[model samples]
Target: MLGRVLGGISTSLFFATFECWMVAEHRRCGFGEELLRYMFGLMFSVQYLAAIGAGLVAQAAASVVPLTRLSASSSWHYGGYTAPFDISLACLLLAIPAIQMSWTENYGNNKAGAAGTGIAASLRAGARAMGSSWQVPILGLAVATFEGSMYCFVFNWTPALDAGGGLPPPHGLIFSSFMMACMCGSSFFGMLDSSYRPVKVLLPVILTAAAALGLTALSLARGSTSNGAVFAGFLIFEACVGAYFPCVGTVKSEVVPEEARAGVYNVYRVPLNAFVIFLLLTDISPATQFGACCCLLSVAAGAVWLLGRVEQTR
Candidate 1:
């Protein structure tokens, strides 16, 4: 249904092809998961470069056109085909040769015919994998809890700030700064040892996360705190979050079974989605919600330590 709405039959076909290729890539990259995960972090950092460019374009567009008028319309191209769309088309065209020239390696040389089990069997296998390792779901939930809190802020920060002492309305500048921090964090964490043992690295990252969330709770608690202080706390939190992606990705790669990686990851999102929904449905203040996030991060740090112990024992 969504595919039909997006680009009719063409989008559906594109997605079908995309997923098939992606699963192949996933299998090839499964063994060196940490390195693959680190590469993804670097890729994300590159994506943020695109984001910065987009923001600049948007800002420039705003300067020439009144935001009020721009916001009133859904179409940015009343003048017919837009330059952005043209550039997108050209990029897609160029990517064909780029992809062909890209590095290709697969650690596992299993026959392509043995790529997957039957759907029913695969589903059953995935279910079994969920219970096969406590480390998988436990670490997954812990990471999700921490990330879900960050996403809550991403979606609600503007209103959350507005509610607390009439802090200034949200602007693009704050979001751009947060993305910059995230990029830096990803780059920094990517340089860490790409070992399967993530406990040593994750321990400090999670602890820092807890401390940052604690500060956020504190900043929000004091209604009299200057908005600058609150904003700074948020920035610090974002900076810590930079390392979170590669760290958690490494942990997930360490524990998640190769056959069930996709299914297990989807299961991991259940708790995260539920957590965010609960927060959004309630009328709780940002401080209260942030305090809750702090507790979750604290629990996650402990769980991560225990997970490390389990890994070492094995």
Candidate 2:
């Protein structure tokens, strides 16, 4: 219990600190940032795609024939559990020089101003500024809910498949396929014309995602759908997940005032982190949780559609 609590806090703090700053830095790029941002998104997708694909192959091969360069005993081996981390640490060490060479002056310091005296005061002021516009909070809520659902899927999809769909362990095939689909999704969205507004594009994507989630939930609950069908449904949903980062970033740049962007972004994380933790703690069946996600996605779709209509007026 204590470990879970600490893990959640540590995860939340790391994301709130690092992720928010990353977004802020992207925003500071000024012109053509959307293209750059989504390009970065595409790079991220490719990175994961390759990593997941490699991991799938390695794990599958290890399952068939365990590799043991260093072994405590016959049953204990290095390949499956320990070798990956060693490789990762080695890669991290190798990248340090490149990372140092690429480092730039902190862009966040430029955004920081005397909005208030301290962190608390700055948060209060940012909140007040955001509250002055209803759209800010509404958009924040919608994005948070949407992002939270994606995170839930990230954490639970494998277990859900194993327990409810009769899928077994070592889900490399499914994971890699999803990552590949995500890569295609991100690339497609990144290439779309800039004439289209972010909110307008998101409305339909959100609706499609909700429909996919609903189908997936039904498949999980009834077991009428084949594994292929379940996988297809999730692939479609993963495409939407890929587009979501760029779309929400576009909306944030448009709707959020410049001064409060960082604070409001962190504020949005509150509901997202909260929802994820709630779902994590729950003992409900996977099908039931997926059904709940369908409902939540439906609401989020409606909210984003309304937000789009309002954005048209502005």
Clashing pairs in 1: none
lDDT per residue, candidate 1, 1-314, as tens digits? Answer: 78435653443334233333444476565545445666656765776666656545444444453323234655444222243344555766986888678835321234463456444654465578879988876787676788777767776666556655654543546567777877887777777665535567777877886787678678778764466666776777776787776666656655766556545655565577688788878988888788887887888788788888888889
- For candidate 2, write residues 61-152 as lDDT tens digits: 55654567555655756665455555656766976787578755343544355443455754675697678887888797788778888887
Candidate 2 minimal-lDDT segment of 10 residues: 107-116
In Å, residue 70's CA in model 1 sits off its true spot by 9.4
After best superposition, candidate 2 residue 50: deviation in angstroms?
Answer: 4.5
Please state the error at residue 219 of candidate 1 in Å. Answer: 1.7
The TM-score leader among the candidates is 2
Question: What TM-score fits each model?
Answer: 0.73, 0.79
Which 10 successive residues of model 1 have the least lDDT summed?
A: 11-20
Cα lDDT listed for each candidate: 0.65, 0.70
